[model samples]
Target: MTLAIENGSGKATQWQKVMVVAEPTRESAAALHYVLSRVVFDNDILYLLHVENPTFWKTCFKKQSSSTSREGGGCYGGCIGGDVDFLDQMKSACEVVHPRLKVKVSRVETDAKEKAYVIISETKVHGIDLLVVGKRQSLANAILGQSINGTIRETAEYLVENSKCTCVAVQRKGQTGGYLLHTKTHRNFWLLA
Candidate 1:
């Protein structure tokens, strides 16, 4: 937990390392992208983290060669390595929006039910200052209830409740099909769409 001294205010502000939880869904990326567009500092590090479930055998060994980027609407090939397609897209999007910001990608394998715990552990180990996650409706929510994407939302909520660092849960404005433009200065507050 390093404190950065501000020149004007003469106050110490902690805004160095930030971690964003990335999922395969576009909403997840968009939420992270929204965060990136709003927050910027002189020397900040952005971490993109994706947790994979061992139970999902389909993506366990799906490796592609170091070829060109994928066409149409699919994962990019050989972006970070093989099989880390989600991180690839996220990194690319963040670079496009904030080219100067230092960005890193991390992929972890964990139990299906322990995603939140893994993220919290990583945040502590990495000395993260903020943790950002996307909130969206999952397919299971349709079958179960319509509050949120059950597992991921639960993970975000747990992080918000228990993490030593700050936590932010972003959601797309689905009703009006808008975006969350501002969440930096207005902590826990969101703009329309």
Candidate 2:
């Protein structure tokens, strides 16, 4: 979904456009929604993607196979209702806040490693001017080391580091919100000060 907000300051400047990557996680989705509401931008597009990593599922099933033999039925890591429902909830929340924003959702059939590539590829393909993502709390990220941030940092780090588009990482505060904005238009890629 694309939402255009005129800068309340009557300066008459071109509104900047941004593309937000939506993951089917409650915390991540809520964080993005909070950031979007707080940020004063002109146009915003929401790209919701549900990546089904067959490899990850295979690995998970492999781990459970031996256990299942001893126990009754093995745990099949396929039908994830939580992830599916989270996306729907996020879509509804976005619509309630920014009815005009254009929202697009797609199912990605790729592993975690390839998911980053797909996201970056789609970003370029869609001519996205900016990329916005939710940042997990440091503690949560450390506990779940192989998180989306780590994947992006490892796989698409170069793309994110060298791309000409702007990238913003938003995190939730006690009740408010905080954001880290980085502009990669100049010297390679560096964090915004």
Q: Considering every candidate listed, which one attains the maximal lDDT? A: 1
Among all windows of 10 consecutive residues in model 2, the one with the lowest summed lDDT is 184-193
lDDT of each: 0.68, 0.55
lDDT for 184 in candidate 1 is 29
lDDT tens string, model 1, 1-193? 5567675887766558888888776667666866776655545788888887765534433422222434332334222333557677778877887777788899899987888899999999899988888765457654675235444445655666678887776767765655643232443355654
Where does model 2 exceed 4 Å of error? 1-17, 39-44, 57-84, 137-159, 180-193
Model 2 agreement with the true structure over 123-187: per-residue lDDT tens digits: 77777666666554456545765355554353323445655566655544444433333334432
TM-score of each: 0.66, 0.59
User: When superposed on Cα atoms, how far off is each prediction in RMSD?
Assistant: 6.3, 7.3
Q: TM-score for candidate 2, please give it.
A: 0.59
Off by over 4 Å in 1: 5-15, 58-84, 138-153, 174-189
Candidate 2 lDDT score at position 42: 28
What value of lDDT does candidate 1 attain over all alpha carbons?
Answer: 0.68
| Native-referenced Cα lDDT, model 2 | 0.55
The residue pairs found clashing in candidate 1 are 178-193, 179-193
